[model samples]
Target: MQKPRLIASDIDGTLLDPFEQITVRTAAMIRRVIAADTPFVLVSGRPPRWIPPVADMAGLDGYAVCANGAIVYDIAAARVLSVHGLDALVLHDVVHALARVLPGIKVATERAEPGPDSAGAPFATEPGYRNPWGDAESNVRPRAEVLGHTATKLLVRHEKMTSEEMSLAATELLGDAVDVTFSTNRGLIEISAPGVTKARGLAEVAELVGVARDAIVAFGDMPNDIEMLRWAGHGVAMANAHAEVLAAADEVTAPNSQDGVAMVLERWF
Candidate 1:
């Protein structure tokens, strides 16, 4: 492969190891890649608040595509370069539709705080909806307060349905009015504006950085990463990737715990 111009990677199960930390070897590999003048962009289902810490771990000042593809973040500037958020009206409608179809469903919206403290991304979620990991610096409030404004992404959860099942259901009900995807945690579905995905976010970054689609390499391990993998010239899946992601990828690497990302970059940098 002709060396990649832009390297896009997913966090959690893709870049960080099982411990959710960037290993020293992985950090060294990232530094080497950055030294070669390649831009590393983190595209994740996470909010911008979770990105700065990961960028620091990589030992580079990089940008991020947060909330799936809804927000593009400039890490060093601590600014949101662009955002594709659901309109307030649309958000309200979708929530109602989901409630009608899935009674007692939990709804939460991820709002980008003015900033983060020693605390991490200041998330405003509904009272009952916790993250996939069961831990986040989340502020739980009444649904009235949570759904009153436009948001980057919405989390829809049900006690019985996995995110995968919820994703299928939401897609069937909402169709193109909204974009629905999920994470490793199958408990909740994350909603974005129509047509937004990791690929769309990466495309924006590639344009901003002047990298062609063919020269971009992306790594991912979930259904959310499907479009990004398809969009990249070299789309790699983690060995532990979801079945859909593994099938969509051009290649599969070792598990993230084994420094799969670093092992691949070594071949290039």
Candidate 2:
């Protein structure tokens, strides 16, 4: 196969180690890829608020896929180039419906906003409410009051519930109105705008950079990354990746602890 001219990777459970930091080997390999004129984009389920720091640390100036592709951010410009958000009406209905069915769930919403006045600001913000089930004495606000605009994504966290269980519950509740997946091994569910996926975000980045999808190499380790891994010309699955992710990739590299991303770049670049 021809060498890739672009590289996109998921952050948690893929490129970043368990501590959520890039290793020296990974940083060096990223530098090598950039020096070769191959741009690497960080595609994550994280909100835009948490992407810039990671980009700065990696010395990347490209786009970032945040909120599981609901938003595409330009790191250098500090702006959002594209956003696929859930319709306000749909979001309200979904949130309310989910709450009614799954009580005690914690709902978190992420949205784009101006950077902080201080230097090195984090883009976007997360402001929402928490409501526990069977707590009639609680004074939690309504879901509408908590969500003011189009919600880029909704995060549901429940300590007693498993990620898979929450995901299944969300799917059953939202159905075709949204896309739901697990962003972490812990019990957290990520909800994205319908039709938004990591693969879609990477495609937009490829178009913006004038690179063919076939010239992109992607790496991932979770179910949310399956589409991206399959979309790239060279799909790499981390050794610690889930079985589905491993099966969808063209190859498997070492785990993040072993600098899997660096290992791939060292050989390919």
Candidate 3:
């Protein structure tokens, strides 16, 4: 494998533990990676509003590829450098499509605005869509209000089916018109613009940081991280990652609970 110059990792299941905190070993190892002159980019399925705290927790302020691929955030400045989002019509159409296939699915929109992160500046999501990461500041607006404008990302959730099941049900209904992925193993799916993935977001970061794609290594444990892992020089899957994620990886590390990311970085650094 090429000696990597950049390191990109997915946040929830790949970097953060079950409780959403970076372990001491992981933090120390990330410090080591940055010390080795390689930027540690947090490529996640999170909205831009959620990046700062995670970066602060890691004690690293490298770039973050957030909202699947719709946002490229500069964590140090707490600003969005770029965004690729779905317009109101697109999201409305998606809601209709999913509603047809899966009845009563909850829809949440992370709008691109001000006051916080990305276009979903303050985050105006619907009531049924709980913030999976325990968000404290989401505006529980009506579903109509949430879908009234363009959004950096759209979140859909169902009371029953797992994310994979939801994906299967929406497969024909959603062909390649958009990018759909799940960070968690539950009934939630995050949607971004067509062809947008964390890999694209990281590409923007690469251009800014002057790191070649082949000189980068990435880690992930969910469908959202699939393209990113495949796009990197080394795509590592966590031992407890989804089956598709495992198949997509060049190697498999320990589970997140075991500090998988830190283990790999320790060896490289």
Ranking by lDDT: 1, 3, 2
Q: Which stretches of model 3 miss by more than 4 angstroms?
A: 113-121
Q: Which number leads on TM-score?
A: 1
Error of 3 at 232 (Å): 0.5
Write one digit per residue (lDDT tens) for candidate 2, span 1-269.
67788989999888889898999889989999999988889999877767888998899988888878877888888778888877667766776788797887766566654444524212222233332322232334455644556667766767678777888888987887888888665667877888889999889989999999888889999989988988889999999998888999999999998999988777677
Worst 10 residues of 1 by lDDT: 113-122
Cα lDDT listed for each candidate: 0.86, 0.79, 0.84
Q: TM-score order of candidates, best first? A: 1, 3, 2
- State in Å the error of residue 204, model 1: 1.1
What TM-score, over all chains together, does every model reach?
A: 0.94, 0.87, 0.93
Question: lDDT by residue for model 3 over 1-269, one digit each (tens)?
Answer: 75589999999888999888899999998888888888999998777767888888887776888888788888887778888989988888899889988997988887653335334344777887766556576788887778888788888988687888888777667989988888875788888889999999988999999988888889999998999989988899999899999999999999999999988877668
Per-candidate clashes, comma-separated: 1, 1, 5
The better-scoring model by TM-score among 1 and 2 is 1
User: Over all chains combined, what TM-score does candidate 3 have?
Assistant: 0.93
Looking at candidate 2, the ten consecutive residues that score lowest on lDDT are 120-129
Candidate 1 residues lying further than 4 Å off, grouped into runs, are 113-122
